[model samples]
Target: MLGRLAVDVAIYRDRVQVTERKSGIFIDQRADHPFSSDTQLVADATRFEHALSHALRQILKTGAYMLYEPRAVVGPTDPALTPPERALVRRVLQDTGFRRIEFEDE
Candidate 1:
């Protein structure tokens, strides 16, 4: 892929999975623990974001700073996600600095 194509983010209620599409560097992490939280996802948006950002940084070869310019495919596939929940997902991805975002279900 040309300079790292993109990353795939799949967020579950209690877990988040990220894959760097080019290198296939993937991370499947619980939403709690190091970030500190209950098992429920989105319960604390900051914590969820922290955990996600952490996962992304771990997979991105360059670093989390590289997040801003990259295209990201975010698919939150639990029960198809409600509109507000989808909006939350988008907002979080945007907050993570992804310049381009696509939803797998949309």
Candidate 2:
């Protein structure tokens, strides 16, 4: 349906970012590679690839590059998340294209 097709996509050199703004923050996620014509349901297709790639690698080991559910950029990480647990956050955010948010360890 047209409503389901209204998602946005951002292509990076090494990955594609999909975002949906909620509240005031942007829920940004990366797709591990550049996007092509065959990709579906993209809005605001722009040259933000570098911005994403850089944020993924240069910012904190856990950066805003991976937020599956875009809520207001609130306080720190949940007290229950560990180091590897934190990485799981990264993976889930990356896998948003498939509507997934669970880690193998979970």
Off by over 4 Å in 2: 1-75, 97-106
Q: Per-model C-alpha lDDT, please?
A: 0.71, 0.33
Return the TM-score for each candidate structure.
Answer: 0.76, 0.23
lDDT of 1 at 14: 66
Summarize candidate 1's per-residue lDDT along 1-106 as a digit string, tens digits.
3363488988776678898887778899776644322443455567778878878767755543343378889775755666766677778878877778899877
Pairs with backbone N, CA or C atoms under 3 Å apart (clashes), candidate 2: 15-33
In model 2, the number of clashes is 1
Cα lDDT over the full model 2: 0.33
Name the regions of candidate 1 deviating beyond 4 angstroms.
33-43, 61-68
Q: State which candidate has the highest TM-score.
A: 1
**Tens digits of per-residue lDDT for model 2 on 1-106?**
1112112333333343333332122335543343322323221233233334443333223233343442211123223345553453344334323243333234
lDDT of 2 at 10: 37
Sliding window of 10 residues with minimal summed lDDT for model 2: 1-10
